[model samples]
Target: MNLARGSSDDSGSLLWGLGAIALYALISYGLDYRARARRGSRHPAREALHDLKDREEPQSPRHRIVSRVIMIGGGVLTGLVAYTTSGTLRAVAAGLTAVVAVTAWAYYDHRTETRDSAG
Candidate 1:
């Protein structure tokens, strides 16, 4: 398969898969928002990693279940679409590139926010 272009048949699935990825991101963000509200913390992602002393209580069972479902199901489906569009190697490369780029961006933004708040 061409790296730069997708076949017509694959285009629709790719678009749909992209949409699923976006939805997963939005849902994850929304989960973070709810977690923030529960914890009364502005940076939920940082706090959610551990059971901080100030955390009000454990998240509800429903919230926890929904988070798992969205993460696993959405991720698997998006990955499947990517693999179907291209072969294994290309899909892995694309997925890694995306993950790395997003992680770097998030880290940079987090650092900036911390610096701004400190100063």
Candidate 2:
């Protein structure tokens, strides 16, 4: 049995899956915007732009720990999904990539916080 050739038959299924993801993202964004509006954020775009700036205050150690835990949990969930949908190799790659990415993010955040506090 040619696995590659057999997988080609499910090309349409892949497209449908991608389309569903896109639709879900759109709805999520819409709901977030609605919530922001309800909160009296008259200038959502401006608020978003402002949010891109460095935070004036550093996150507490407790918050950082919680964030890291949540991020790792998300990575594990992603790995499980990849394993079930794809294969062992892909799952390992995805899980490792997620861990590396999250580590890099944490490092960067820490560096930024240190720099901001020092200067």
Candidate 3:
């Protein structure tokens, strides 16, 4: 499928992609709702909209490792999807962007950890 050309064949794939996204969103929402219910949160919408503050407890090293692994895996998956759907160039760009983002996040996390430990 040549995505560069506005071909009718692309429309079916686009619709399927959109449907998949919608289904995933719905499932995510349901899970969040269940979690909120379990927590006895009255204002689910407000809680969802609220920015995540730093946790009172520090994350364990294992947790940090798992989080980083998941982040990198997500990036790789995104790059692969872009490669299959768009092209090599787009995949390369996406992969690079993901790497930069992950690097920045890791640096920020390290700085925060050091600052917390010092003070």
The most accurate candidate by TM-score is 1
Candidate 3: tens digits of C-alpha lDDT, residues 1-119: 65554454444445443443343334334444554567799976455333122232344565455545654454554444443354455445545555554555455555655665776
Q: Which portions of model 2 miss their true places by more than 4 Å?
A: 2-8, 45-119
The global Cα lDDT (0 to 1) of model 3 is 0.48
Question: What is the C-alpha local distance difference test score of candidate 2?
Answer: 0.49
Evaluate model 2: give its TM-score.
Answer: 0.36
Please give, for residues 1-119, the per-residue lDDT of candidate 2 as tens digits: 56743444444445443443343334334443454577799876455344324232465565456645554454544444343354355445545555554555456555655765776
User: Model 3, stretches more than 4 Å misplaced?
Assistant: 1-10, 49-119
lDDT by residue for model 1 over 8-117, one digit each (tens)?
45555566556546644655455555656786887666665443222433334444444345455645655555545555654565465445444443454345445555
Any idea what lDDT model 1 has? Answer: 0.51
Clashing pairs in 3: none
Ranking by TM-score: 1, 3, 2
Query: lDDT per prediction?
Result: 0.51, 0.49, 0.48
Highest-scoring model, lDDT: 1
In order of appearance, the predictions have TM-scores of 0.40, 0.36, 0.36
Candidate 1 least-lDDT 10 residues: 50-59
